[model samples]
Target chain A: LVDALTDRELTRISCGSAFREHFGAPYTVVHRRDLHGALLEACRKREEITLHTSKELASFGETAGRVLARFADGSEYEGAAMIGADGLRSRVREIIIGDGTPRPIGHVSYRGVVPLDQVKDRSHFDDMVIWIGPNLHFVQYRLRGGTVMNNVATVASERFERGERRDYGGPDELDEVFSHTTPHVREMLGYVGKDKNWVLHDREPRSGWTRGNVTLLGDAAHPTVQYLAQGACMAIEDAVVLSGKLKEAGGEINAALLAYEKERYLRTARVTITSRIFGDIIHCRGGARDLRNHLLAQRTPETFWEVDWLYRGIKA
Target chain B: LVDALTDRELTRISCGSAFREHFGAPYTVVHRRDLHGALLEACRKREEITLHTSKELASFGETAGRVLARFADGSEYEGAAMIGADGLRSRVREIIIGDGTPRPIGHVSYRGVVPLDQVKDRSHFDDMVIWIGPNLHFVQYRLRGGTVMNNVATVASERFERGERRDYGGPDELDEVFSHTTPHVREMLGYVGKDKNWVLHDREPRSGWTRGNVTLLGDAAHPTVQYLAQGACMAIEDAVVLSGKLKEAGGEINAALLAYEKERYLRTARVTITSRIFGDIIHCRGGARDLRNHLLAQRTPETFWEVDWLYRGIKA
Candidate 1:
């Protein structure tokens, strides 16, 4: 990716919703020292680095917290401070402040990899398909160099709760979401014929995610629902903003941490609200699907203009 | 108003949504001689002339259509070939288009009026009060010389079908919409109480409002959903743009009329769609109401940002 970017001589970087996934020589993908080495190397060249990982918090500490890591090592890490980029269930999250908890928002999610090679029709390579109804959505996007399609489906359900299934499932549940999709989208997904399922968990905005010198970051500090496609972008911003405040602290890590936490609360709260509001497009069901679609048809891919600033970063 | 403007030497007219009600006054407000004298006087004296009216559609088609207008000698005009600035749903609309019907969107609206003296809080006047919940909305403002408080209530009711109830309503239904309102807003409404109800009708976009020397103007040509509060603003814009195009046509009224029609379609369609999207705030029923309020609370008044150009009028 750096080589491709360097080939173009681009300086500043702000990520869009998707990035191309590349597969090459094993060493080219990750040179033995593993993902951390690759991440650090990217930063070394002034290339903005972003990583998307999902995890949960089992338990908390004042300055540092434990994280449920899903890297190849399967080992947990504890440090003086943690960037809770591990998402909603960040172990760092549970440690920073004990007041927050993920509440069951009564929705289920479905995702799948639809192979583009089998699709035969390549007309949709640069296009996205969003099937929205009152309370449900089925989205399909080209992935894996546009060779494979990534699909995510969501529905508003009354049954699911926090203590239930930890491992979200596959295929059949997603078929139900697609049952009523438009013929064009349904036909495209039909070409792939299978999918995966998961539950969507969301928590309300929190006041603080740090205690003393230790701090929480990204999804650890503030978790957002998926409606805005801002999850990864927000975490990346957390890292950038944290670095900025830390640079200004003059070794007063605690002060820097305070600044970071305070600066972020309002913005994260907004994304939290925006994501949930956008969830309407996903969790819409039955007749809601039609209303949502009609509304979508009316929208110009810029309906949620208020949240644009978040994804665009701090405007330099 | 024209004389006041002339005496003041005003160069521009920019009426925000709050300043929108007095565009083209009904016969009850301005005598015809006074009105024409004012217009002719302005035409001869002023560099520019502008008007703002929110509900003038009550006179949709006075120019191209016949109207039962009684003169001082008890005479009437039919298929009137004069200017139709009467606004949307003009009696002229019925005559020109032969009483075309308004489609029903299955929505009912209630408006409340409060005297400024009755309001205990004035701080909110800087921003409009929008208490929106599932399937209903309570909109309040300090309008008309800032002496009176204006409140508009909107809701989507399955019970209110097209052509079923066109009569203005009273307080019972208004109270029903507020049954789920937050206590704070309910108390506010109780303070102002009811003034009257409005029959919020629906209509699809029309292809053309002119064919010959006569042309439809304002609401007579296009009507809007009040969600974006651009209904009157659009009419005023239409009046201005149509006038501009007419003058530019240089005696080719037919060409100018066609040009105005073509120019207004896309902008109005955008406004139409945006209005409905915004109407989503009031049309939501049940859980959607809570969702809408949550969304609105999270929204910045910068919601105005989305329609800046529309309110400002289309660019060349």
Candidate 2:
């Protein structure tokens, strides 16, 4: 989606894992000395994605109804408006809404990415399969052109007491969630390493999805856990809806942005709530699981078959 | 699998809704008659699958193999071999592998069969999915041509010494296994009615898979908690291997039966042990779940993927 509606090219960055895993190749195998040049070239080609790097707004300036985002480098671009996809620690989110502290979700998610063929019995599973057991749940899905499969496992916890960020989410925490999963699942997780990732499940909807011509999308506007497999789906939806409103609203940046949030907030909020509802249903009380099973036995295929056409034909 | 081998054409007893669920609809509706008649007709089809229901063998009629069965109609069919697939309480198993009564593996399972549609979010799960959480574990699977899903939830219990059918399985006894499951799971019991199947996890491999022509199969031969979704799989595998061995010996029933037991005993024993390993992984100390997850992360897809394949591909 980023490839559309912009003249700016993209640059990708990582320790080669994401490159091989997500896009199946790295931007280049050049030395660190050439990284800046590589990034600039990537920006030219509109193909840059970064992790393990620092990003900050070098300058936030306003033009005729346009917000300018100047990075640390000399790169600057003109746009009708800037969209912030920055996440939970979103600087724009903090600057615009003034809510600096992130609320604890009382949940933690452990995530990994493995190749698709690595799994056993693909005949019964799907491109995206979820195992929602009692207090914890996990999702496995294909990505990177189906060359790799990603896994995200979460566990419900009432304990979100503050602790050192570095110390809190480590191997011990990831292990805790798997303890309740099956041995089959335990065997599945045998490959996660420090090279993997874990994230806390605590973020609120941004108070304002937009400021002037600048707006937020994806995790910045409405952060959510992967419970529903709707994170990327929402971001894509946001892009489409925003572009539609922007093109239709014409010259009024203010009206367009308001309309975008109005058109999107309640809908996204509903999804956010629904996602959480689904999570609770999967991880709720013991009897709830029973009722869920009974209802599934009684209701699933009928309900499940319709999902493909639901959400107004949104395809993931 | 059950339908392909059944005498469905002769017997047609639809289970109102009781015991039919755990077996699913395919096993229920696919089989033309009630379990009682189906068993009888099944026995007639190859005259091979005998209906031992209500048949009690009084003495061991020695034919190289001592028979442990007695017919209800006062008939005897002693052969060179015998088996005890009578379930958790097997007279054959008892006589052949004499020892103290079976001991619970510090766990007991809650079993229920409910209308498939009754389970809410049923589509969100698979016909077979295992949920593992600290101190709690449950498995859900669809049966009867995707009509109903059977559920078996397990939890550790030091004792069930209460005056609730210490020797007989009953609904009240079944309810306790679900005490810690989700509430939705508990509500499904509305369909549980008078017939409930909760059994202690008195699972141990048979010390002897054969006592001459008398060989055991299914739960009687080796009772297993549904930790790995391999119980029914093993039974089916048993039939295949036993039949193969019998065929290989050119209908020399004695040699074939012995080989069948020999081949199956080791395989079944290994599966049972792995499931117990899984049980320990899921239902052990709170700290253990964490350790299990950590161990999984350290493993690569190559490491666990082949192991899963080996498990699924194991024959006989």
Candidate 3:
């Protein structure tokens, strides 16, 4: 994987123990847009997968051994099994499991990329640095081959009302939430885009996802909170396992769907739940915050292998 | 009310300041089944109310300005508007809101009613005693006017598997969970019914509960965990408020339903979330547990009046 990237795109080397100790494995930092472009190009080359753009799902139903999907343009498509890989606000999911909406878990994040030279203090530009504090965290890392630095600052905002998604939160609120953090963290906050705040939302992991000839994948199935940074990784893993299960089932759609759900539900649920609990532990106040910092400060590369199961590819 | 009951059914009076100082309102101590029977009798006297038994709901739908409910026995009933007052496994709720099931919140309780004479200690029989401890709580109160002592002991069970409702927990497990409690609390636990234990389950407070001519009430709408003891109170309040809204709406079912939801959602949500948070606070461990106990012990009768809103009933 390291050999596939140019030297500039390779993960920058640094003496940041927080980065080196936590992720003992090789890491590369690429902008998510670039990663998506590469994967989309790879999909475009596959003759079996046809891409559809602007085809909004209106509703879906199953009948007479086929899954029928209707689009907003009044066109219909039939397939043996339909996979709902649509992101959050999924119409396929709404048709499958009616009416329940994703809930806001009272947190928001402001993210943007800045040219390295544009930043006044580029001290941590070569390293992934995460400053954890009470009810807030600031993460900065190099992206797009170190030419651009990506920053995500999240706060547990009481002002982020439940059931409402706001696209842009005021910069004053951002400053207030991060005012207590170190000067370096406050510096990273300056690079956040003017109107790019995302109010984070997630659904409680459902007990079941597959029903008959229709199933869900990726964010549609498990819209995990972004604390773990495993949302994309889990989705890619799901694609592999789901395809493998379908192939192994030999055209038995129901069996394949059941097998896929069984294989992935536990692992995905663990990841989602662990990530949420990790956020809770790191976002504690008073004594608990002290305990969390004391524990994190003691992390060493050998002892930080708890995430080996996550980094290592899924077992066959 | 006291004069209406026979001597054996009258509430036992004692010099306990806790009971007199806290409630400051009319109270009763009747077995739930008996109280339910009395309410049913009262409803039977009303010419407009009709009671249906053993009628399991199959499905329901609304059409032609009426809500049509189908029963498993092929019988059907249609009404201008329908209120789903069905309990936890409500079929009406399933028809209205699909696919989501109640989740177990990793707790279980053993409850039983023993004759007061059967117990060796009768020290606090006249008073409702609640013992809050780390990851466990014990509540005991008199019922049936002191003839029976109702004991409910709940434990935060690590052994309790998710999504599995165990009917009978082993005595050894029960003993292990309550082993750290005082001797008096342990004595109360000894009277737990041998073959009866309840697995507590609750859903996240849903944002909306009404659609068109149909709505939900009580546990069907918000199946709250029993920590707050407001489940029944909320349901009764729902009945009063829902009926008032319908009357005020002047035959407009949709408007009435929406009004009922608007009037009740915030209040019920506050109750449910507060109860869950109260449980979390009381169930803390180590330093947190000590803090909770300290706060609880220092609570005066006036201080406990924080729930005046709950007891005083919903405002018009």
Ranking of models by TM-score: 3, 1, 2
User: What range of 10 consecutive residues in model 3 chain A has the weakest lDDT sum?
Assistant: A1-10
Question: DockQ of each model against the real complex?
Answer: 0.05, 0.02, 0.01
Top candidate by lDDT:
3
Cα distance off (Å), candidate 2, residue A28: 29
Error of 3 at B185 (Å): 2.2
Q: For model 2 chain B, where is the 10-residue window of minimal lDDT? A: B1-10
lDDT tens readout by residue for model 3, A233-307 = 888899899989989989798899889987887677667666776677656564344334434445553443556
Best by DockQ: 1
- How do all models score by TM-score? 0.48, 0.40, 0.51
For the predicted complex of model 2, DockQ is: 0.02
Superposed model 1: Cα runs more than 4 Å off = A1-37, A40-86, A91-107, A114-116, A126-149, A153-177, A180-184, A190-195, A266-311, A314-316, B1-190, B194-305, B308-316
User: Which 10-residue span in candidate 3 chain B carries the lowest summed lDDT?
Assistant: B1-10
What local distance difference test score does each model get?
0.55, 0.56, 0.71
- Cα lDDT for residue B203, candidate 1: 53
Residue-level lDDT for B271 in candidate 2: 66
- lDDT by residue for model 2 (A12-93), tens: 1232463345443333222223544665576677644333246576656677776777777666655677777787667777
RMSD of each: 12.9, 17.3, 22.7
